[model samples]
Target: MNQKQEIQEGLWDEEAAQTYDSNEGVFAPEVLRLTVDRLAALAGPGKALEFAIGTGRIGIPLAQRGVPVSGIEFSRPMVARLREKVDEARIPVVVGDMSEATAGEEGSYALVYLVFNTISNLLTQAEQVACFRNAARHLKPGGRFVIELWVPELRQLAPGLQAVAYQTTDEYFGIDRFDVVSQHVTSYHFHFGAGKEARLFRSPHRYIWPAELDLMAQLAGLELESRHSDWDGGEFTADSSSHVTVYRLPE
Candidate 1:
């Protein structure tokens, strides 16, 4: 297997795909309502394509709202899980790396979206830039590309600290170890279940700031349209922890 395939398997194999759907907090109706509403509005009358469309989490609901949606995914296991929810005719998915893969013919989509910090999964600057270029290639002249990413929380760390605990609870613990010089971060998740059952998952990423993300988009012939703190159009501020940014290709 190639490097990309290895990464996909390491992070999203069959077991991970099965466990992914068990997160009730992430799949709640209230949480999905706003996200689907915003994406549907952005899709307008044309089709939308989702990069890394894991288990059809967002794509399925967005399609249910009357927008034509397709996806590009690297993990066959994850795609199989998605297939269990919807058929190929309703929501076709091509198995490939999003960084350089083509989901369909060029200029066929009105919107392209990457969510939940998936861009950082590329783990390299070149790959992330290529993913932006790939999105531009698949979009119509007036199409929009959207991304929802968390702002790096290095500021929360003390002067000499390299790690930050983002979540701590009775059943779960989450921490991120940061390498400031390299912009590399590894998130460590520890889950504890009943009867002494425990599990750990680690995912590495290359975190990008908003300014640098805009530069990548510019390199791909896309212009920044708007940025917000969330899907509800909250203003993006210095204190915001995450952002929803939209970029547009010239008409």
Candidate 2:
């Protein structure tokens, strides 16, 4: 793949797409329930658009809740996996980059959401800002844009260390190598099986602080509405590991 394609799809190829949901840790029923619940409530009675809606993990359930959901995804294989669950007629998806792609009619959606730390996948500040603008372009005047991202745990790293272990188990391991100067992170995940070889997958990302993200929202004509530690609206605090933030376009 070329540089552009690499940036767009990253490591989400056919094999990754096929096995994406196999990680039951992320696909747990209770976890998705919270996500879909919050998204459905934010969507209200209007249409919703999801950026990088891989495998329709949330989109399928949101649509099942009677919300009209659309998506923008760059990986054809991921979309193909999504199609296995729901037809295109139910959840229309535009195959393109979330940073600049136009999905549905401009300003037609009541909600545009990017979840699961997917914004970091953009790999650049400019692309991340453009993603905000793209989400704004798809929203109605009062529409909301929501993002679920992990707070960088640089505090966990000892001085002079560039890597942090995010997960460690007998069956799997995950770590992030951070470049503080460039605000970039490369996540490496290793899956192990008994009597089988270990598998590795790594992807690059550009991490953004909440304050920086708010500035990007401002640049896109969106204002910070609410930020919580989770979908249940827990208070965000210094010790929080992840956040779900909401931004709104003025009416």
Query: Tens-digit lDDT track for model 1 on 1-251?
Result: 87866876889989889999998877988878988999999899999999999999899999999999999998899999999999999999999889988987889999999998999999889999999999999999999999999999988999889999999999999999999999999999999999989999999999999999999999999999999999899999999999999999999
Candidate 2, 1-251: lDDT as tens digits: 67968755658899989998887966899989999999999999999999999999899989999999999999999999999999989999999999999988999999999999999998889999999999999999999999999999999999999999998999889999999999999999998987888999988889999999999999999999999999888999999999999999999
- Candidate 1: residue 219 lDDT (0-100): 100
Please report, as a residue range, the 10-residue window in candidate 1 with the lowest summed lDDT: 1-10
Runs of candidate 1 with Cα error greater than 4 angstroms are none
Collision pairs in model 2: none
Give each model a TM-score.
Answer: 0.98, 0.97
lDDT to native, each model: 0.94, 0.94
The root-mean-square deviation over C-alpha atoms between each candidate and the true structure, in angstroms, is 0.9, 1.1
